[model samples]
Target: MEHIRNFCIIAHIDHGKSTLADRLLDMTNAISEREKMDQVLDNMDLERERGITIKSHAVQMYYKFEGKEYTLNLIDTPGHVDFSYEVSRAIAACEGALLIVDASQGIQAQTISNLYLALEHDLEIIPVLNKIDLPSANPEEVSDQIIDLIGCKREDIIPASGKTGQGVDKILEAIVKRIPAPKGDPNAPLQALIFDSVYNPYRGIEAYFKVVNGTIRKGQRVKFMATDKVYNADEIGILQLKQYPKDEISAGDVGYIVSGIKDAREVKVGDTITSADNPADAPIEGFEEVKPMVFAGVYPVEIDQYEELRSSLEKLRLNDASLTFEPESSAALGFGFRCGFLGMLHMEIVQERLDREFNMDVITTVPNVSYIAYMKKDPTVPVKVNNPADFPDPVKLDRIEEPYIKAQIISKSEYVGSIMKLCIDKRGILKNQVYLTSDRVELTFEMPLAEIVFDFYDRLKSISRGYASFDYYPIGYRESDLVKVDILINGDPVDALSALVHRSNAYDIGRKMCEKLKELIPRQQFVIAIQAAIGSKIIARETISALRKDVTAKCYGGDITRKRKLLEKQKEGKKRMKQIGSVEIPQKAFLAVLKLND
Candidate 1:
């Protein structure tokens, strides 16, 4: 334990967290020169395509410092705000963190977020200025920013570029000299914190854990403290950047516990693993389960794949605890699952995975936040409404409360005025602002999560010309002037198209949704009318003219008497069809309204 060093790489998205991990692995010779690829820690194709980290990965490295060898355990974490939970779990398992900041980008919103999390975990922060190879890189300036923000001295900061593999060896040496070795008792009752887990076809389930105390050995009986399900450790292996067989995982070391538990639901990410015969008195405070804040209804584009979509979601949910779903029915959309997600990006990821990985084509409704509805008769009985179909009548509602977030944005100083305007337009209350440097600024606001759930990110990017990056955390529910805005298609309410909107922006948003829907929805045989309404009051409406059939084509021979009567009959029949006929809204319409990309 004295020679073991457990630390993680923490940074903002696209800030070289995964690249640095690869460099560290290469420097330690954990992998052969031929075995490396860019962003080796992010194995998913989706992650590579987006150039972002989606999951947390752990690896073991061996390095020599001052004639003494050290076993370095490095956990690479996601840098996006959506995966902040993963960052926290990674930090919890580590004694120190290599805080990587882009020398070109300087400090970002998620950079500050991870820094605060590392501080809260009491991890020794080793400031690293990455991407020094770029022409725009300013290591000295970033080091000064790190000193100002984290209170670390400029001299203590290490400058390196993961791209060019510069100063990586120095980083490894610093990890050994600065980061404290794990402290735990080898003879104590067994207690391990499961930081991550994955399902395997042959291996059943693999529970990745850091042994807090005692030993986890093969053939030993163990159980998860959270689930209380007993399993014999069929195999033990060290994560030497790859699975290497091991006889036992002693305290303060990181390894995986493999049993015949193939079911992913049996093992959870934050569960404690301990000896069944001599379990610890208490479980360690390891990881927190992420709660989803955004909710949407996902239905199959082809109705026959409903069962396949259901099974796929079930399988996905086994590994993703943050994803939640329940059976939901729509009059226009048929049957589907009402899914909950951590954020919009998370929602998009699940959808993309379902399509790319699971061979499923699913259509998702507009994303929304759960609203707390109070009964007028009894204010004590508050109900959480995720779907608009279950939203109570206006007569029975007292006041609705919606989720709010403490939002932060780091952007160029030139775009500060527009960013503030954009935040104010989204019902954001400016809380604070700090000019980080002459060229950069950090703006803080308390905004409704619902306000930013739709097109706020896209608009923010557009308004700032992609110079601004935003991060946010939930700040609980706040009472507000919110109303359920329902879309009525040809005089019928479509529950799936309903949304809870703030009164201030209700009219404009309703107008925009109607217009977008008009563009996406096809022209039916009869005229289609789209109306956005609050209760019975319609604030916005748009019309799509009917696709007229050339009834006069066949009447070219006679037009004086016979054609006039035939045309009159055709017009009457069309009027009746318009009264009773329903519009078949395509899948694209639902997706288009949810997306407000300009």
Candidate 2:
């Protein structure tokens, strides 16, 4: 039998990790000549269009060097900071990591964070310098920086261009020599670590896992350690871009197993799967439950499309286990679901998919952070609140803890003063600053999560003329004086647009939010008043001017079909709004005003 080597490709966003994976597949002929595809592992449409790996994808291949065949199991991990939890899970499944660094841009914030995670796991690290084909390629300089930052040997740096397939053979050779082979007992009971799963109408729910210490076949019965549910394996296969049937997968192999599971919730990522007869001694530890950091409410524009909206969410959840939903009833907007996500990008992807894929119109509420509240002097029991409407009274809140993040920014030396001034205005605490190069500098700051959730990154890039890159990670929680500012339309709480803000900037924030709302909300048949208030005190108000005239005022009896079509269009337009008794508010209005600083 050939030796097995497992490794993961890690890098910062836009650092060419996915591209390198594709080149490796081509070099090894893992994908057939006719079956070649772009970003072969990123099968999701959203992932391909966005040019980022949102989920972890696994594939098994064979490489022959010097007449010796080696089995390579490769896992592609997400590069975005929001999916750090997923990245860690991928790292745990591998015996080593291949760190990819941009030749032009030495090292980034995410690069340092991921490198630290690999070190924590005690995985063998293979540093690779990519993008050598570019005109500004500086492999020598980047290699020096990597040696300084990560303490890796200067000779360990493999220089290559993933775009041109340069030095790809060297990377494959390193994987075989540096990463240790799997040395587990194959006769033992099946035990695997599930890193991801997906649901398909024809195939049911499929699971992707790494066989850590045993063998599994097509007909064996297995049980999930966390759920305690038994299932008969109907099929076993390796994912060659897509699932390919296999008789069995032994230890150290990355593949998928399907057992006729219909419920997506039954199979969760990070759970363990073992044989039914002789289960594992204990479930693999170190799996941290993912809590959605951002919350929002989703409803259909047309009341009759409620069922369609729910179906769309179900389809989305089939592939994405992080997206969560619970039925919610709104006093002003009727029934909907309160959805939770990892971050703003995740939330936006779901919303956009619903509209683009399912051909359904959806109205989403403003995204809010989770808050812990204490009521009636109960120190032990803490309530998690997502909406301001769900928040307790100010007096009942003994102390409020908000999430904080450590942000690192890189920019030209000339824009340092302007960037620092902006950070201070947003309540950022300077941590440290270092000169990375003659013209480049790295600045670190501790800032509230709420401040970074807005368009702060975009503003920083704009001020620096697109020469700045920023990244952040959750540090901890700190005490802050926070209050919920509720928006009212026609004297009733909208519930969808309520937000929690610092007590100091309540008035200015409310005014700016209301102004954006007025611009996004289209003029209705009747004038609609928008107001932001805190307990009977109005902080800001704006009005949407009434429609100047009817869109179809020249309808005649001879053109009944045309008139009917026009009326249908008008009614459809009206349905894309939340009506508060007599006031009409568009869906875009709620989204536009949610992040005032954005």
Candidate 3:
């Protein structure tokens, strides 16, 4: 156990965490030259295409230091804020973390937040300034920032270039010397913490875990404490580039187990795995509950495939434990699931995976944040509302409270004014601001979670020329004057398109939604009236003209009255059709209306 060093790499998005991981694997001879590749831990196609780590990957490596062979288990974690849950899981299973900071970018918002998380878990922190080879890299400036952030000595910070393999040996030496080995009793009852799990069509659900005590052997009976379900460890192994089967994995080692449990709900992340006969007294604690930051409805393109969609989501959820869903039906989109996501990126990635991995055609409605409404009749009772259609009537509602978040943005000083303006326009209040350096500033704001659900991230990136990094966490709920904006197509309310909006910005958003729907909804044989309404009042309206079939074409060279009669007849037909026509809302329009700023 003394020679086993378990640690993880963490950083802001695109801060060279994966690159540094590659160099560590290369120097340690973990992977053969033929197996070397960029972002080797990231195996998913969606992760590769987006150049982001949507999932946390764990691998075991063997390193020799001073003639003594050491077992190093490194878990590579995602840097995006939406995937912070993955980072938290990795931290719970590790003894230390390598806090990677970009030399040129210095310390960003995510870096600070992730550092706080690692600190909270009492993990040893090793600050490594990455990207030292870039011409724009300012190692000295970043080193000072790291010192201030973590209170580490100047020489303790290692300056390394992940791309060129510089300081790779030094990093390995630090990991061996600074990060302590896992401490546990091999003679005690089996207590393993399951940090992650994946589904396999051929075998079953495989759960990846770290053994805190005792030994787990192949073909042994195990029980997940959370589910209280027992299964035989059909296969037990350590995770390398591939699964290396082993007879047993003892204390202080990271490994995986396959029990042939086909049901996805049978396995849960953060659950404790114990020996079925000699079970541990209690489950491991400190596992943070996942709080979803965004909500949206996901409906199948074909209504009959609802069950298939539900099954696919279950399997997907087995892989991604952060995803939460409940069965919901929409008058406009039919039966669907109301899904909760970590953020916009997480939501988009889930949508993409549903299409590519499961081949399930789905329609996603506009995303929104959860709210709480109090009834006038029962002032003490608070009703949770995620769907706008679930909102209570204004006459019966006492007040509404929306979720607020503390947003932290690190950017250049030049874009401070613009960033502040954008946040204020979204009904945000400036909470605090500080200069990390003469040219770099950290701005903090308190804003509604719903405000940032749409295009806030994109706008911030554009205004800052991609120089800013944003991170946020919920700050609970606050009273607000919010209204539900119901979208009506030809006098029929479309429940899927309805949204809760702040009363101050309701009119402008309503106008934009009406115009966007006008452009996205295909022209039908009858004229369509699109209106954005708040109860009895229609705040905005747009009309989509009918696709005309000229009945007057055959009246050419005839009497003027005949031509007029043909035109009149066509107009009467359109009016009749309009009365009976049902407007078909295209899938693209559901997403486009959310991007009003774009």
Q: If scored against the real structure, what TM-score would every candidate get?
A: 0.96, 0.90, 0.99
Model 2, position 333, has a per-residue lDDT of 72
Q: Which residue pairs clash in candidate 2?
A: none
Query: Relative to the unseen true structure, what is the C-alpha lDDT of residue 170 in candidate 2, on a scale of 0 to 100?
Result: 96
If candidate 3 were superposed on the true structure by all CA atoms, what would the RMSD be? Answer: 1.1
Candidate 1, TM-score vs. the true structure? 0.96
Question: Which stretches of candidate 1 lie above 4 Å from their native place?
Answer: 557-559, 575-581
Model 1, residue 305: distance off in Å is 3.5
Ranking by lDDT: 3, 1, 2
Model 2, residue 428: distance off in Å is 1.4
Question: For candidate 2, lDDT tens digit of each residue in 175-243?
Answer: 999988866778777889998887677988888888887998898999999889999999989887767
Worst 10-residue stretch by lDDT in candidate 1? Answer: 589-598
Candidate number achieving the greatest TM-score relative to the actual structure: 3
lDDT tens readout by residue for model 1, 1-598: 9999999998988889888888888888888878778888888899999999888888899998888889999999988777787788889899999999999989899898889889888899899999999999987888889999988777789999899999898798789889998889999999999887776768777878999999988899998888889999999999976799898889999998789886656877778899999999999987566778889999998888898898788767655657888998898888999998988888988999898878998888988889899988999888998877778898878988888999999999999999999899888999999889999999999999988888788888898897798999888998988778899998998887888888887898799889999998888888889999999999999999988877777766754788778779888998999988878877777776666545
